[model samples]
Target chain A: AQTVTQSQPEMSVQEAETVTLSCTYDTSENNYYLFWYKQPPSRQMILVIRQEAYKQQNATENRFSVNFQKAAKSFSLKISDSQLGDTAMYFCAFMKRGGAQKLVFGQGTRLTINP
Target chain B: SQTIHQWPATLVQPVGSPLSLECTVEGTSNPNLYWYRQAAGRGLQLLFYSVGIGQISSEVPQNLSASRPQDRQFILSSKKLLLSDSGFYLCAWGVGGGEQYFGPGTRLTVT
Candidate 1:
């Protein structure tokens, strides 16, 4: 059984500033994938970024990037130059490499970007 | 080139009512389908997933059930509704190692 944990229930950042959301997971599997998803007010889950367990390099998507520490089982999402549109609920997820794989998601952090 | 649709965007029913939520995918065939439930202000809980027609895997032991009658259509059903079952239900599709796309989601309310 795998589980994801997001310690922060809510977070706020000023516009144009930077913010980092922390995430940690518990998994015994060696090969897996980590992902960050954002859900806006529309309640649509959108992919932010992804990192493979085997890869040492962190994943970056424009303003969104990750600090993945495989040994410590930590994967944190960093938002650079945050904007008002960045206000949403961010979730960290994990999936093992196998048949019919399903994602295990964190509780989520409600992000608010204040102007 | 692929899209997913789930309806009724919102559903309201009393206790013990039957449920049938439909999810259909377009521009893709034989894609893996999933059903997830989100409690209020909570994370997603994967309830069921299907690899192909007649192949369904349930992750939670709940009152909900899922079926795939067609290659691109996945359905979630319940014989009777429970108040605890009220939440936003999401439908998603994916191919191996790729990203998963989510539908707008159906807000189910059982009173």
Candidate 2:
């Protein structure tokens, strides 16, 4: 069994500042994928970024990036130049290489960007 | 472009009532489909997933059940709903080892 953990229940950041949401997972599989998803007030899950276990280099998508430490099983999401629109419930997810592509998600962190 | 849809946007039902939530995908074939539930202020819990038509796999042992009647359509159902079943139901589709695209989600309330 695999599990994802988001230690922070809630987070706040001033507009134009930077914020980092921490995430960690437990999995025995050597090959897997990590993802960050954002859900706004609309309750729609949006993909933020992704990192493959084999890739030593972290993944970056514009203002959203991930710090993936495979050995420690840590995958943290960093938001640069945060904006009001970035306020949402952020979830960290894990997916194994094969099978149905089922995702294991964290509890989620409610992020608020203050203007 | 691929798209996923779940309905009816929101639903309210009393305890012991039957449930049927529909989900469909467009612009994709043989893609993996999934059903997830999010309780109030909680993380998304994967309920079921399918790799192809008529091949369904359940992740959790719960009162809920899922079926894939068509290649692009997945349905979640329960003969009798429980108050614990109240939550936001999400449908998603994805390819092998790729990111899953989520639907708008359906808020289910069981009183």
Candidate 3:
């Protein structure tokens, strides 16, 4: 079974500053996928970014980037120029290819961007 | 463009009452549908998933059950609601190996 772990329970960043949320997972499959999702007070889960296990180049989306270390089983999310709107509960997820393709998620990190 | 819809947006039911939450997806076919629950101030726990019509896979043994009558519609039901079942229920659709798109979610309060 694959399990994602988000070590940081809560993180705070100043507006326009940068913050990184750490996540690690346990999996045996070589080819898989990792994702970061953001859930605001609105309760809508939004995709922040994703990284394929076969890709070494980190995935970047606007102000969000991920540092994916496959060997270490660590995928961390970095937020640049953070804004108040960025405050939300961030989750790390893992998905295996070719099988049931179930998505396993982390406990989550509560991010607070202070103005 | 693909969109997922879940209703009712918010529901309040008494303990031991029946529960029925409906989720539907548009702009796609034969999609993989999922049902997840998020407790207050907590992360998401996947409750059920369906690969196609009439196929349902449960992640954990709980008080809830799920069904897929149509290709794009996934339903979560419980004969008797428990207080612990009170949480925000989310519906998502995905293609294999792609990021799953989530719906606005349904807030269920079981008193």
Candidate 4:
């Protein structure tokens, strides 16, 4: 079985400041994928970004990027120039390369961006 | 483009009542569907997943069951609801091994 851990339960930052959310997973499978999802006050889950385990380069989506260390089994999300809209609950998810396409998610980190 | 829909937007059901939540996908065929539950201030817990029609895989053993009657339709049900079932229910669809796209989700309150 695979497990994802988010050590930080909550985080707060000022608008335009950068923040990083830490995530680690315990998995025996070498080939897999990692993802970051954001859930705003509307309660809608939105995909922020994803990183393929085979890719050595990290994934960057505009203001959001990830630091994926496959050897260390750690994948962290970095939000640059954070906006008030970025204030939401962030979750780190793990998925195997194939099969049922099940996503195992971490405990989630509640992030608040203040002005 | 692919889209997923889940309804009703919000539901308030009493305990011992039956549950029937529907999820449908558009613009995709033979996609994998999943059902997840989110408790208060918690992450998602996968309840069931289906790769194809009439194929359902349960990840958790609880008072819930899932069915895929059609290629683009998935349903989650329970014979009798419990207080523990009060939470947000999310429906998602994906193709291959890519990231799954989520629906608007259903807020279920078991009173």
Candidate 5:
């Protein structure tokens, strides 16, 4: 069974600053996928970014980037130029390529971007 | 463009009452549908998933059941709702074994 762990329960950063949310997982599968989702007060789950295990280059989408260390099973999300609108609960997820391909989610990190 | 639709943005039902939530996907075919439940301030919990019509696999055994009657329509039902069933429900779909796309969740309150 694959399990995702988000070490930081809560994180805070000032507007225009940068912050990172740490996440780790346990999995034996060699091929899989990683994702980060954001849920604001509106409660809609929005995809921030995704990473394929076979790829060496980390995925970056503008202000959001991920550090995917396959050997250590660590995938952390870094947010740049944080804004008040960026305050939300971020969830780290893992998906295996075969079998259930179920997305295992972490506890989530509540990020607060202060003005 | 693909879009997923979930009905009844909010629902309130008494304990022991039945539950029926509907989800439909458009602009896609033979999609993988999923039902997920999120408790207050919690991560997503997968309840059921369907690869095709009438192929539902449950992740957790509970009072809830899911049915995929058509290619793009999935339904979640409960014969008798439990208080713990109170939470936000999200419906999702994926294509070509690719990334999952979520719908605006429905909040169910079992009072």
Candidate 6:
């Protein structure tokens, strides 16, 4: 069984400020994938970014990036030049490379961008 | 491009009533489908997943059941609803070893 943990339950930051959301997971599988998803007030789940365990380089998508430490079993999300729209509930997810493609998610972190 | 759809955008049902949430995908064939529930202020919990028609895998034991009647249609159902079942339900579609795309989701309120 795999479990993802998001230590921070809630976070608030000023608009345009950078913020990092921490995430850690417990897994025995060697090959897997990590993902960060954002759910805005509209209640739509959107994929922010993803990182493969085999890859040493981190994944970056415009303003969002990840610091993936495979040995430490940690995958953190960084939002640079954050905007008000970035205010949302962020979740970290884990999935094995193959099989049923089931995703195990963390409890989530509620982020608010203040103006 | 692939897209997923889930409906009645919002649902209000009384306890002991039945449930039937439908999900469909467009622009993809034989794609993997999944059902997830998100509790208030919580992350997503994967309830069921199907790799093909008539193949359903349940991740948790609960009052719900899922069925894939067609290649692009997936349904989540329950004979009787419970208060604990009230939450946002999300439907997603994905190909092999790729990221899954989510629908707008259904907000279910069991009163």
TM-score for all models, in order of appearance: 0.98, 0.98, 0.97, 0.98, 0.98, 0.98
RMSD of each: 0.8, 0.8, 1.0, 0.7, 0.9, 0.8
lDDT of 6 by residue, A40-114 (tens): 999888999999999999999999999999999999999999999999999999989887888899999999999
CAPRI grade of model 6 = high
Judging by DockQ, tell me the better candidate of 2 and 6.
Answer: 2
Q: How high is the lDDT of residue A32 in model 3?
A: 93
Residue-level lDDT of model 4, residues B44-73, one tens digit each, is 999999999999999989999999999999
Distance from true location, Cα of B96 in model 2, Å: 1.1
Residues A3-115, model 2: lDDT tens digits: 99999999998999999999999999999999999999998999999899999999999999989999999999999999999999999999998877789999999999999
* CAPRI rating of model 2: high
Model 6 Cα lDDT, one tens digit per residue, B1-111? 788889989999999999999999999999999999999888899999999999999989999999999999999999999999999999999888668889999999999
Question: On residues B2-86, what C-alpha lDDT tens digit does candidate 3 reach at each position?
Answer: 8899999999999999999999999999999999998888778889999899999999899999999999999999999999999
State the lDDT of candidate 1 residue by residue for B1-111, as single tens digits: 888999999999999999999999999878999999999899999999999999999999999999999999999999999999999999999888756889999999999
What C-alpha lDDT do the candidate models reach, one value each?
0.95, 0.94, 0.93, 0.96, 0.93, 0.95
Docking class of 1: high
**Residue runs of model 4 more than 4 Å from their true location after superposition:** none
Could you give me the TM-score of model 4 versus the true structure? 0.98
DockQ of 6: 0.84
Clashing pairs in 6: none
